[model samples]
Every structure is written in structure tokens, then in C-alpha cells.
Target chain A: MLEQGKIDSRQAILLIISLVLPTAILTVPAITVKHAAQDAWISIIVATMAGLLIARLVTDLSLRFPGKTLFEYAEEILGRVPGKVVGFLYIWWFLHANALIMDEYASFLCSAHMPDTPVIVFFILGIAVAACAVRNGLEVLSRFNQLFLPLFLGLLLVVFILATKDMKVTRLLPVFDKGAIAILKGAATPASWLGEIVIFTMIIPFLNKPKEAYRVAALATLFTSFYLLVSILVAIMIFGPNVTGHWIFPTYNAVRVVSIANFLERMESIAVAVWMFGGFAKVGVFYYAAVLGSAQWLGLKDYRPLVAPVGVILVALAALCENIVELLDFLATAWPPYALSVFEVGMPLVLLIVALARGKGGEGT
Target chain B: MKKIAVLLLILLLTGLTGGCWSRRELTEVAIVLGTGVDWMEDGRIRLTVQIARPGAFTAGSEAGARGREPASWVVSAEGRTIQEAERYLAMKVPREIYWGHCIILVLGEEMARKGTGMITNFFQRDRQPRENIWVMVTRGEAKDFLETYSSLEKTSAQAAGFLERMKTGYSVQLWKLAEMLASKGIQPAVTAVEVKEAGITPEPDREKKSPPQKQVGLAGVAVFKEDKLIGWLDPYETRGLLWLKGEAMKGVIIVPSPGEPDKAVSIRIRRGSTKILPEYDGEYLRFMVRIRVEGDMVEQQSREDLAKPEKIKTLESEMADELKKRATAALEKAQNEYGVDIFGFGDAFHRKYKKEWRDLKDRWDEEFSRAEVNIAVEAQIREIGLLTKRAGVPEE
Candidate 1:
């Protein structure tokens, strides 16, 4: 197996945020608006709380086994065969997740700009760039995220300021118009996205200051939730609940209405560029995790050789995802419970039982 | 080292190509300034495009003529679809047709009456057209409508731009159309333009009489129900509709006394808002509409005393009653005759009572017709005009 490179707590936190937050902000608002109406933002808040609890559990698992990855610890805790099975399943999840992210990025680009260009070209180019980054190891990815994070946050703030002229705060009135159950349903999909932090249990061994891992993860989770909440609120204010639900990308459409004195009109092109940047970062992180997980599972000497082949497989799976409707349906109904079982329920319970039985429980380092 | 050099060469070549996928130079493309859509007798679509003459625009001044038609060109084509018509027009021209700069979309009365769904799909689906472009329906053939040049503006395209800037008139943009289409309980309304032949006095010296002069004016509004144009509202009714919809911008309202000739007051609108409250009274559903307006007095008649509070109160009451009367008449015509709920009553009900709407979703139109509406107008004359009294006021 490839020797793991050490990542500091700060780099790990940035990696998690760069991975999970981008797609969460871009995709959650439109999906939540359809089911939850004006209370969609509330659903995001609830989902964030659930995400925090899952983060705590995953971090606790990491503290139980210091310097050993989840793939290695599972065999020591459970029998070797079952641990291997779980390891293989996690690899499959990462591969599928990366493919879905790639599809989302390519499809969004196709709809917003360059409609005539084949989406496959974007998929191939995006995966190729991501493969190069993954080959450089986690340190390079983390550094790239650190460099671009400020730019991403600045663009978001600019979008908020420019859209203030059209924002109607009254549109958010009559809160909980649908009921509590709708909000709960809306929270389910985003909670799954947030729960992907379980991957941190595997990566925590790489952190230089393993003790500070929980604090960094919590901070990253908090920032991501706040960003997602702002995105939902902006979408609801620009387009009323009825119209927001109908749009595929309500935030993009909301930015399309940003006309500052007529000369600054059609700045949606800039929005498209920013969107692609964030999407690429997200896909890069996920693709790296998938390739690394595959190499670790296969017991290969190096993950570098596996990166290109896995990247091709991920792109093909993304192209096979039928259409937008099927992708959405899969995210809403099937993915959430599957993700909860692996990330939230299964991993945490396994670590808890193993830690109690071993009786060497004061947070291994 | 050899591999690195090969990669560097490939990168340099890629950069040298400039990597512009869909860029067309300004000179190589016919920048569509405006587009007009009309319906033909054989059920085909006729599209007229106003393309700017790039060379003439650069030359600045024509050598031979005084006006010279602003040095622009117009082309018309007919086909089964808007895209097909565009393709046909492209065949007659040497340059690529670009619509990124197109500012206006005009629909003729016949085409609008038949339906605007098909006409709007082209703009919605096309990547070149921006969603902020203004949409209008004309009262006559759209081709003839675009042919009319204005004396004040450089081209008919400039005239169309002026009309779009007149926010006081009934105006709708593409985003608003999309909202109306997506909304469950609302219909779309667009400004209407009409071409009327201007009477021209023959110049004895000129051999070529100016081809029958035409002028464009804002005429009524085209109201659509489920993408089909149901009916229209006259200019006065449109003003009233705008007031009720809280979209009125600086239009003047003239309130004339019943039996007194030349006895009228002109009020200029400053700000306005309309609130629709839906109430269920066990038997009949009723809507309570409250309109609040603030305006300045621009004209006065009958030598009414202005300094007294009671006199101001009387004037305010009279103005409010006049506004209510006009607004009620507009509502009555839309409700009783046309039976189209253009005022977004369904949206109000849906927002206020979501549970009830879920049950009454299918029969919304029926429920809207049966519902009773009460209108109340509150007008405040904040200030008198610069000339408080009429120009020919009697010397008290």
C-alpha cells in the first residue's frame, strides 16, 4: 500500500469543507424549496445539527485508533473478512459519489453556458484535471483549497450585495407554511451530504495534531452550514417560494436578476465561472478519496497507478446516470438512508463497541 | 527532457489558437437590434429583424442624403418556426445572425391571439437571448410595425428602446413572463403597441412623397391565461390595472366633475400599493382590496378653496372615490365580461390559504368568478403643484 502522507488538522478541515460545502450550497436550495417551501432554510438548520452529531461520532472513532486508517482498524476490531467487505463497500460509495459530482458539474455547465459543446468533453477535461491533483497527494489538494477559499467566499459576498436590491424579505413570511414533516423531508438529502464527513475517520490518522481534529472538523461543519443557509435565504428572497420551486438552479436564476444600473447586467456569466470553480474543487476532493480508497483496499504499492483508471470509470458511471430527473430521484429517496447506515450509524457503533471492549479508552494518540 | 519539450510545444500551440469557442467578431456578425413576430394567412410565422449596418455606423455621416434612414437595414422572412425563419433570413445575409444584443421582442395581434407559448419558447430555449429583454405585443402586423421609423430616434429599434424605458406604461420582461408561467394561480400581461398612419402634408417640391408615414403608440395590454391571449384591457383600464397591481409609476390621473365642463383636477402619482385580503364568509367568498396612494395636485377647477382642511378633505374624498370607481370598473370588465383573473387573485388566495388551495386547485377559475370583491382607495394629496391655482384664476 502507498505510504500515507501526514496532513495537519487545519489542512484536513479545509479539505472537508472544500469537498462537502460546494455541492451542498449549489444543489440543496432548489431541492429543498420544492418540498419544504418557505421553511426550507429551517430544514437546512436541522440537517446541520444532525451533521454535527455525526461528525462527533466519526471524530470519536478516529481518537480510538491513532495512526491507523479506518480500513486497518476495522480488521482489528471486527473479524478480517467482514472488515474487508466493509472496506470494499466504502470504496464503492466513494467511486459512485465522485461520478455523481462529476455529472452535476458537467450538467450545470451545459445548461448555463456553452450549450452546443458536448458534455462529455467537460466530463473528460474535469476528471483529467482532478486526476492530476489526486496524483499529487492530499497536501497539494489542501493547499489548492486554502488558496481558493478566500476567492470563493468573496464571490459569494458580492452576489449577496448585488442581489440586495431585488431581495424581498416579506417573501420569507408565513414560516413553516407547509408543516414540520416537509422540513424533515427536505433535511434528509443534505444531511446525507453532510454525513459524508465519515471519510474523516479514515483521514484523521494523517493529521499532525490528531487531538485537535474534532475542533477543526466542527469549525468546518459550522462554516459550511452557515454558507448553505445564506444560499437558501437568497434564493427564497429573490424568487418567491412558488417560482423558486420551479427553477432547476434557483440561486443561479436569482443571480440572473442582479442588474445594478443596467451597465452591470448579464453578470450571470461571472456566476457561471464561479460555479465551475467551486464544482471543480468539490469533484477533485471526492475523486482523490475514491482513488485512494480503491488503492488501499486492493493493497497496491501506490495509488498513483489506480487514479487514471478509476477516473475513467467514474466518468463512465456519470454518463450512465440517465438524466437529471433520475439523478435527483436517486439523491432524494435512495442515497440518504444508504449514506446514514455507513457514515452515521454503522461506523460510529462499530467504534463505540470496539473501544469499550478493548478497555484502552482514553483517546488513543 | 524530450517529453517536456513536446508538452511545452503542444501548450504553446493551444494558447496560440486563442481558445474562443463561440466568439463572433462585431463586424462578422449581424447584430439583431430587434425582432418582430407576426402570423400569416397560411398559419406560418413571419419574422422581421432589424440589423444594424456596421459600415454606415462607423462612417458617421452619409455623403448624399440628409437623414438617410440612420444607415441601417431591415429584413423579413417567413417560415413554420421562429428558428426556421431565422435560418432563412441568414441565407439572404452574408454575416452570422447574433441575438445577444437584441433588446425587444414584438408580437402581432393575430399571433398573440392565437397563442404566445410557441413564440416565447424560442427565447426561453435559445442560449443567445437574455432573460431581461423586453416583450411587447403589437396591435397590427409586426413587420409593418418595425418598418415605421421615428423622427426623434435614429431607428425604429431606438423607438422600441424608448418604449421599453417608459416604465409608466404597461411593460413586462422575460423573467416576469417566466414567473407568471411557473406560478400556479397567475396569468401574464404584456404591453401592446400599435402602428397608426400619420397624416402627412405633401411637399410640393419633393417628387418622391414619403412612403405612407406611420407612428407607434402604446395601446392597451394583452392578457394571457395559460399562455393563450384571452383578451385585452384598454389604456384607461390598463392604468387602473397597474394601480391595483402596485405597478403604477408616474402616470397622471384626471378626475373630472360630473356635470361641470372644464371642471377637473389632475393628480400625479407619487407612490402606491395594493393589498388583497381574502375572507371566507361561510357562504360566499369575498376579497377585500385596500389601495393606498400618495400624489401631488397638478391642476384645480371651480375655484375651490385650498387653504381649509375641510376643503382638502373633500378633495381627497372625491379623488379616492374617483380612483375607486375607475378601479372597480376595470375589475368588473376583467371579472364579468372577460372572466380572466389578471389581477392575481388566485395567487393571493394560494398564499393566504395553502390548505384550502390544495383542495380547490382544479376549480380556481370557477371560484374566482363566484367570489365577491370590495375595493377601497385611500388617496393623499401630499403637495400642490408649483402653480397651486389654475393659470387663469380669478383675482380674489
Candidate 2:
């Protein structure tokens, strides 16, 4: 084994949640609303179901090869060169997805907090902290996330609750205005977002109780969808569906709209702080998986040496976004099926079907 | 080794503490309190901003020391666009401009009449302006309202914000404006401000003549037809609009007594709600505006009320009649004259008649103008004051 770490089932669920939710809140509502309009909430629900379906498939594949990662089992299922190619593609996927997450983090901080700060400044600062946590091994990163999720969720709930003052039921009227096809078209963006839950394939090997992955995945999916659902719903109710589509970060704008007796106002900092916590966790998870997966592919004695060089590469990739507009343009148009769903769901399905036909592993757990 | 490591950590922390280029100190920024926009005659935007001077705030708590130099400074600049005007305004000010605490966005009468489409788009598209800031249209120039003095609060912007919170007229914030404008079958109507003379409290002395000062006060609301100011509604018409929109609160309605000609009774509107019952009968559409009001009989000049239920009934009927008249006048103005659906009756009709709305949405203004609206007000006297009759009259 390249690493020795054991995280409980609950911690596993929280880790998966930390992996998906933070960036989902940043841009999903606006992108979904662009296609779905007033029916964006319906699109989000459909996307959640699709996401859970993919999570189930990916979790099933991980269970078929218990106590072993996809990298290890791919070699067993297929021949050496093909398995290595699949493993190498996943490493690239993790790095690419992690870089996008970093890009989202910097874009949000710049617009919501400080607009003039250089993108490289945020890239360096964000990667430095995330890299530190990744080098601490999986258990340390998971435990650190355990301490952060509750605070992040608590602050998030507080903002939404205070934001209820502005909610108008009339804004959500004329339900299903855009019809089913538009709703589905809107669902594509967040559906691809939810598919990121396939990161569990990389983490199942480290779970103390690997058999609980299915139940944990289901629960985490439910928990995460509730947040995403309420986030878009409140944003629509407060800003109206058409207006909600105009904001860059509707969730943060929703938080900024809260005014309780005028004394409790302008709490964008709380939203910013919550996202910062999620950013660090999400970046750490992908960074750790990418580094560890590369070490496994190369048969290295230690994975720590690759962390520094990989962090440098991530900084370079994150800087690829010229500005927030270009970043959102990519997220909205091109990245859905190609950059995200391919490795997260496509190859995993093929690998699972191929293994099922050949009947590889799972004889003696 | 521990001491050496601690020193190294401190050195690194020192080098990394000051944030990136966006970092700033408090004294280096000018806090914007109010923003006013005007349309110049030569097709340009005139931007006026009320910036708070923190140094003048410390002289508060003493009676005579305040208002000597004023607590806020007003400045204006002009350009082809709002952003250009703002850049010019920025060039004139030494400190960095911060809009985190902006209290209001005021549009001048000409600007509102010309169009508020660009202003609405510009404000929401910006990252700094708040969603809760009050949006109002002034009778003359917005710059005057921004510069007008406020006696109750330190600044006119704060005073106008407080006025909106009190629901003086039809209160609309930036978010509400955006929602109304963005949603179909509805239009935006915002509160109004006008510079009026607020006479000094004490009587003017013969020797020392004090100059009359101007104060920004709420003056009903400016009604819009798709972001262009078509007309203005006075306080009573605004109250009627409020009642039609289910927001009537903290207002008073005076009704004539049943039999008496100049004698009347006063009813304080505790709360009210309006329901739009859209009826589509295949050939024609009719809207029944069902308004229910509950009020307190705070003062009465009629002498026929000595603990009598009949009097309350009659008073309720008369109050209902008054409400109907006011709402009918507003309906007449909106439907017949201005021909705009600021009351969101179109939304109710759309919610109920979604199929008909598909064809009617393009020509909703005409449909609204032609549609028959029936106003029915159900007014109830919830409570009477302690006295059943006149306060100081002896039992006769």
C-alpha cells in the first residue's frame, strides 16, 4: 500500500459532500437558470436524481473490488497497458477538475471580496494551503474536513434563514413555465456537477468499513441535494427566477440581500468564509487523490515528492482562465460532458461492465 | 532550535500579512451614502454622490456643535454613461470610493420619464451596490434631493431610507424593482422624494431672520410603464395602490357620517389585503379586486355613537365606500389614462389564465386597458378607542 489511513463511514460521507457542494453553490444556479428560467428548481431536482444514479453506479463498481482502488483493480480487470492508461486518465481528470475548482474559488473571492487582486495571488495562496493539507495524508485531511463541514453548513443555513425576509411566493408562481425539455436542458450543468461524486471511487479503499459505501453515498447525495435545492429555491424566491439568472454568484447575492432590522446586514463575509472552507477541502481531496494515484501508477516509494510539482502544475492550469466571464463560459458550455462526465461516469461504467463480463475480483474480501 | 523556528515563522508572517493590491486602509476610502442619477439635455448621464465625512461625526452629542459644517459632502460629474460618469467622479475625489453602505439610488424626474432601463441594468450589474437600498424618483433633480438637509437623521439619504422603512408610500428596494421589472405581466413603481421647506421649530424672531432650508420628504410614488415614468401618484392614490397590492398599513382613512354632510369619522388602517379574482368566461375577462380592510375608530365627530353596534356597521360601510372610491380613482387613472399595469393584475390573470396569457402577453397593456375591473371593499371596524362618543363631551 502506498498510504495507510482509515476514515469512518460518516467521515467518508462528509468528505464526498465537501468534494461536491462548495463550487456547486457558486455558479450552478445562474447557469441552470439561463436554460431553465423559472423552472430552474425542477432542473436542479432532476440533476440531483441523475447525480445519485451515477454515484450509485460508481459506488457499486468500487464495492465489486473491495479494499482496492480503481487504479489497482483496473490493472486486474484489463491488461497492464490498458489499465495503466485508464489509471493515468483518472489522474489527469482529478488534476483538471481540481484546477477548475481552484479557478472558481479565486473568481468568487475576487468579485465578492476584492476585485483588483491578481488571479495568481489567489492561485498561489489557495494552492499553498491546499497542498499543505494534502501532504498531511488522507486521515488528517478527512479529520480537518470533519471540523469544517458543520461550521460551513451552519453559516450557510443562517444566511438562508435570514434571507427568508425577502422571499416572495409570487416570484415562484406560474410553476413549470419553461416546460420539461427546458428543465432538462437546465439540468445538464448541475447534472454534470453532481456526477463529480464519482470521486468516491478513489477514496473507497481508505474507508475503514468499505461495505458502507452505498448507504453513505446515498445519504451524502440526499444531504447535498437539499442544500443545492434550497439554495436555488431561495435565490429564485428572493430575486425572482429571471433576475436570479443575472447574478454571477446568486447564492452569495442571496446572502448579501439579507437585512434583519437593518442591524444584521451585508454578511457576504460569512458566505465567503463558508466557501473558503469548502474550497480548501475540495482542492485537498482532488490534490491528494491525484498525487497518490500518480505515485501508484509509477510504483513510487513515497507520494510526498510529487505534491510540490503537482501544486505548481495546478497553479499553471488554474491561471488558464483569463477572467471570471471566460471561466463561467467554459463551465456553462464546454466542460459538462467532455471534461467532467467522461471520467466521472463514462469510463467508470465501461470499466465496470467489462469487469462484470470477465468476472474480476470480489471472490475473497 | 525552537526559538530560531519561531523567529522564522514570524518573519514569514510579516512578509505575507498585507493582502494583494486590493488592500486598503479605512481612512483611504470615501463611503458613499446616496447615489443620484440625472439625464442631461445633451444625451449624457450626470452622477451625484453623497459621501460621508467621518471627521465631522465626532462632534455629535453636543447640542450646538452639530450641523455647523455638515456631516456629508455632495459631488457630481457628467459623462456619456453611468460608468463613465462614475469614473469622472472618481477622478475628482482623492480617496477610493466604497459603496458597501449606500442607502439609496435616486432618479430625477426627467431621467425617470426618459427611461430607467439603463439605470436598472447598470445598478444590478455592479458588484458593490446593495440589494436593499431604496430606489426613488425625485420631483426635480436627484442631485437636489441628495444635497437636501435632513433634520431628524444626520443625512438626507438616511432620512429617505427611514421614510421607506416606515412605509410612507409605495416602498420599493433595488431587489423589488428588479423583480417587478424582470417578471412578465408586471411593472415597477417606486417611492418618490421632493425637496420641501421644513420650517424651523421656533417662531422667527424679528431681528434675526433665518433662511428657509429644504428637506427631502416622501411624496407618494412614481408609476412606470415598462421603466418609463408615465405618471405620479399622490399619497392617497399611493395608499390605494398599496391596498390593491396587499401592503396597506399604518395609514388613516376619513369617511363621512351616514346622515351628516360635513361631519366625518377617522379610521386608522391597522392592516389590509387585496385579492385579485380573475374570471375568464371564454369571450371576455373580468377581474374582481376583493379588498378587505380592518381599522380602528380612533376619532369621530359624529354624535350618534354611544356604545352602539349599528353605528359601527354604518361607519364600516362608509369606510368601505371611501376605500372603494380611492381604489376606483386609481384604477381609472391606471387603466384609462396611463394604461400601465403597475398593480400586477396581469400577473394574477396570467397565473389563473395561463393559456389565454400566452396570446395576451404580447398585447397585455391593451388587454389590461380594455379589461373590466370590479372593486369590492370589505371594511371592518376592528376596535374603537376607550371613548364611545366624543372625548370631552358630557353625557347628554
Candidate 3:
């Protein structure tokens, strides 16, 4: 093994929370509102169910092969060629996920704060910080998340508390106005966002309580969805469903309303800071997963050598999305059912079934 | 060592590239305190900005002399669009125009009447201008209003902003205007300003200096049909609008005392809130606006020991009647004359009957015009003034 590091279940859950919550707060609400209208919160709840299912598939598969990542266990279950194909697919998924997150981070910061600065600068700043965390390895990455999670959550709480003064409960009226089908359509984007918790497969092998992986994953998904639900609710309450749907980032706009006595106005900078920390962690985890998975697939002795090369490709991929509008269109219209469902759920569930059929690995100690 | 040289080079480079590309030092930037828009005769827009002079407030600066002019400068330029006008302004102004501190936006009557559609794009699209900044319309030229020096505040724009916060009228911030424009049934309402001669004549100056010049004060409200200004509401009507919107906090209301024909009692509104109840009976849509007010009697000219419970009750009823009349007048003008639903009755109706609202949303303005409005005001007189009766009046 190129790296020797162990993270307990608590760290694992925090990693997933940090990975999933920022996207939920920043981008998912607007996308969900566009499809669901006033019922966007319902869409998030439905998506949470789908996310919990994906988490179950991943944890169940990881438990079958103790102390082995998906990269190692794939070959054990399938033949070598097929295993490498699946491994490559996951590598692609990680790179694409990292690119999507980077796009969101860059677009938000550029549009909201630094309009004169190039989007590429934001990408460079983010990936540079994330690259350092990747080079430091998983223990450092988990610890980084553990330290920043409170600040991230604290800022989110403050935004909600300040915005409640302007919130109107009547804006949430006319429930089921669009009916369930529209809400289900809205569920696709957030379901994919929460399904991102399947990144736990890479960290599961290093868990101190590997036996409790299911419980931890379940709790993490529940907590992430809860945070997302409150955020979406507050967003809809502050900017009504009609206005929120039009905004590119509803939660950021909600934070813009955190003015108290004119002295504390324009405090969305705090939200931007929180996102920077959260974005770094998210990109770091995905980048780390990609590097580690590719190294394992290549049968390399160490993954550290691949981190920088892979980081370049990740940044370049992120730069491919021309602008915020194009990225949002891709996220809403294409990315969900195509890439997210296949990798986060399809491949993992298929692997679990094939492993069960072959009667391999699960019977061991 | 080579490493030491690299570190020192980085430190030197850090000094060279100090504050990024967009950084402008305070002295080098023109801080915009207010902005105004006017429709020029040549089919162009006149953009005016009140830029604060940084040296004016700094003690010991030559510009900070007590006898110097006011602490802000008003500049205007005309162009096809506001951005072009601003760029034109950039040509004349020495410092870069910074809009981060701009707290007030004023639209001239021509601009307001022709419509606010063209002028609002700069504020909406620009990242610098905040969304919560107060937006108002001036009775005459916005440029003239921006130039008038306010007696109370250092800058006229600062005075306008403070007036909005003082609850003299409904303050429509940029975001609220955007919200009103986006919503299905409501139209935007902006506070209005007028340049008036200062009521207080400067104490007869020994040197025979010019008397105090004209200053800007809150006039009323500019009511809109969609985004175009259709009419103006006087201060009393603006107060009525505010009462219906639940934004009326502090204002004086004078109502006729119970038995006295000429005398009246002035009540100070401490707090107020409004609730709208809508009833739909398959054909007609009726809205009941319930205004609840709590206030204290500030002046009683009747001198009848009006602090007595029955007198207070009578006073409360009289106050309620006065509020109802004002609210009803504003509502009638909005519904019948302008055919605009400025009070957001449609939103209230939508909240109560969502499905019905969808069917009615297309013809909402017509429906709103036809809908019968009932105004009910319940006022509570919490306390009388320092005295119960006039000093000379005999107690009965």
C-alpha cells in the first residue's frame, strides 16, 4: 500500500457531509425549484431516499471485501479486464464530479463577488488548495473537513437566523400545486447530488468501525438531507418560489438578506468564505479518490505521484464548461440520470449482485 | 542560498502585485452616495451621481475648511444607456467611480412616467450596487434633486436614505421592487422626493450671506402600473398604503374629537399591522383588509378629560374611522382609477385559494379592479398625553 492511514466512522460521515452539503445549499435548490416550484423541499426529501439507497449499496459492497477499496475488489469479483473497465469508469466519474463542483465554485464566486476576476483564477485557487490536501493524504483531508465543518455549519445557521426575519410562511402555500410528477422530476438533480455520498467507498477500507459503515452512511445522508431541506425551505421562504427559481443560487441570495441595523449589511462574504472551505474539501476528496483509484487500477505502488498530474486534468475539465449558464444547463438537463445514476448506483448495485452470485468475499472474517 | 533568493523574490513580487487588478485606494476612488436617472429630450438618458469627497471630512485637509462647500459633488452625463453615461462620467471625473456605498437611487418624473425599465438595469446587473438600497422618484428633475444640499445630513442622498428609514413613507428597496415586478398581481411603489425651499430662514447673517437654499424632502409616493408611474399619492395616501402593507410604524393621525365640531385629537401611531382575508363565492371575489393599530394620544384639543375609558373608546373608534377612510380612499384609487393592484390583494387571494388564483391570474388586474374591498380598522389608544385636559378648561 502506498499510504497507511485510518479514519474512523465519525470522520467518514463528516467527509460525506462536507462533500454533499455545499452543493445542496448552493446549486441544488435553484435547479430543484425550477422543476418543482413551491414543492422543491419535497423533491429534496425524495432525492434523499434515492441517496440513502445508493449509500446502502456502496456500504454493503464495501463490507463484502474488508479493507479493500473498489479498485482492488473489482478484480476479485469480475475478471481483470472488466474490473479495470469499471475502475476506469469510476475514475471518470470522480473527475467529472470534481469538474462540476469546481464549475459551481468558480461561477458563484465570480458572479457574486469578483466579477472582474477570471473564472479560471477561482479554479486555480480552489484546485491549488485542494491539491495540497490531496498530497497530504486522506487523514489530513478528513481532519481538514472536521475542522471546517463547524464553521461551515455555523455560517449556514447564521444565514438562516438572519433571513428568518424576512421570511414569509405564506410563500410555501399552494402545496402539491404542481403535483408529484413535477416534484419527482425536480428530484433527479438533488438525488444525484446526495448520491455523491457513495464516494465513501474509497474511505470505507480505512474506517475504524467498518462494521458500522451502513449506520454512518445512513446517518450522514439523513443529516445532509436535513440541512438541505432547511436550506431549501429558508430559500423559498425568503425569495418566493417564483423568484428563487429564476436565481442561479437561491441560498446565496438568501444570505444576501442578512442585514441587521444597516451595520451588518452585505455579509454574503461570510457565505462565500464558508463555500471556499467547503469547496476545497469537496474537490480534495474527489481528487484524492480519483488519484487513488487510478493508481490502484494502474497497479502502481504509490498514488502520491499521480495527484498533481490528475489535478491538472481535473482543472482543465472544469475549465471546459464555458460559463455558469452552460454548466447549470448541463447539471439540470443531462448530468443526473446519465452519469450520476450509473456510477453512484448502477455500477455499485451491479457489483453487489455479481459478488453475491459468485459467493465471493462476504463469507470471510 | 538559492531558496533564500526565491523567497526574497516572492516577497518583492508580493509588494508589486499588492491588491489585485480591481483594487482602488479610497482616495483614488469616487464613492457614489446616490444616483439619479432622467429622460433627456434627445431620446437619451441622463445619469447623475452624487460622489462623496473623501478630503472633505478628513481634518487638516485644505478641502475640510469649515467654510468650504458641502462634502459631496453631483455630476451628470447623458448617453444611450446608463453604462455609457457612467463611462462618459469616467472621462470627466478624476477618480474611478465606485458604487459600493451608493444607498439611494432617484428617478425623475419623466423617467418614472416613461418607465423605470431602462434605468433599473444598471442596478440589477451590476455586482457593486446592493439590492437593498432605497429607490425613490423625484417630483421634478433627478439631477436637480441630487444637487440640493440637505441641511440634516452631509449629503442629500444620505438624507433621503435616512428619511426612508424614518418611516415617513413606504421605502421600496431595489429587491422589493424586483419582487413586485416579478409577482403576478402586485405593482411597485417608490417613495417620492421634491426640492423645496428650506422652511427655516438662516438667522439674519451679519455678512448678508444668501439665505438657506432649497432642500429635498420626502413628498409622497410614486405609484406604478407594472413598471411605469401612473400616478402620485400624497403623504396621507402614502401613509394609507403603508398601513395596508403593514409598514406603518410611526406617523401622526388626527381624528375629530367625539362631540367637538372644530377640535380634533392627534394620535401617534406606535405600531401597526394588517391582515387580509379573501372570500370567493364562485362568482365575486371580496377582500377584507383588517388593520390593527395601537397608539397614544399626543394632542387633545377638546380638553374633556379624554383619558376616561369611555372617551378613550370613542377616541379609538374615531381613529379607526379616520384610518378606514384613508385606507378606503387609497384602495379605491388603486383599484378603480389606476386599475393596479398595488396592495398585493392578489397575493393574499393566491395564498388562500391557490387553484382559483391560477384561473384568475391572467385577468388579475381586471378581477382586482372589480373585487369589492372592505376596510376594518381596530385602534387602541394606549395613553393620553402628559395632561388629561387643557390647563384652562373647567372639568365637568
Which candidate leads the pack in lDDT?
3
If the candidates were sorted by their lDDT against the true structure, best first, what order would they fall in?
3, 2, 1
Query: Model 2, residue A17: displacement in angstroms?
Result: 0.8
Q: TM-score of predicted model 2?
A: 0.96
TM per prediction: 0.89, 0.96, 0.95
Instruction: Please tell me which model should have the higher DockQ, number 2 or number 3.
Output: 2
Off-target runs (Cα >4 Å) in candidate 1 are A1-13, A170-181, A300-302, A319-329, A332-334, A337-365, B1-11, B40-43, B56-80, B154-158, B197-212, B256-261, B300-310, B388-394
Candidate 2: regions farther than 4 A off? A339-341, A363-365, B2-8, B11-16, B19-21, B59-67, B203-209, B259-261, B281-283
DockQ leaderboard ranking: 2, 3, 1
Docking class of 2: medium
Error of 2 at B69 (Å): 3.2
For residue A215, give model 2's deviation from the true position in Å: 0.9
- Tens-place lDDT digits, model 2, residues B275-339: 99889876587999999889998877876653578877988888999999888877778888888
- What C-alpha lDDT does candidate 3 achieve relative to the native structure? 0.86
Can you write out model 3's per-residue Cα lDDT over A1-365, one digit (the tens) per residue? 75588888888889999878887789999999989988999999899999898988888898889989999999899979999999999999999989999998888878878878888887887888888988889999999999999889887788788888888888887788788899999999999989888788898888887888988899999999999999899989987887788778888878876688778778788888888888888889999999999999999999988988998898899999997789999999998987666988888888888999998787532
TM value for model 3: 0.95
Candidate No. with top TM-score: 2
In model 1, residue pairs whose N, Cα or C atoms come closer than 3 Å (at least 3 residues apart or on different chains), thus clashing, are: none
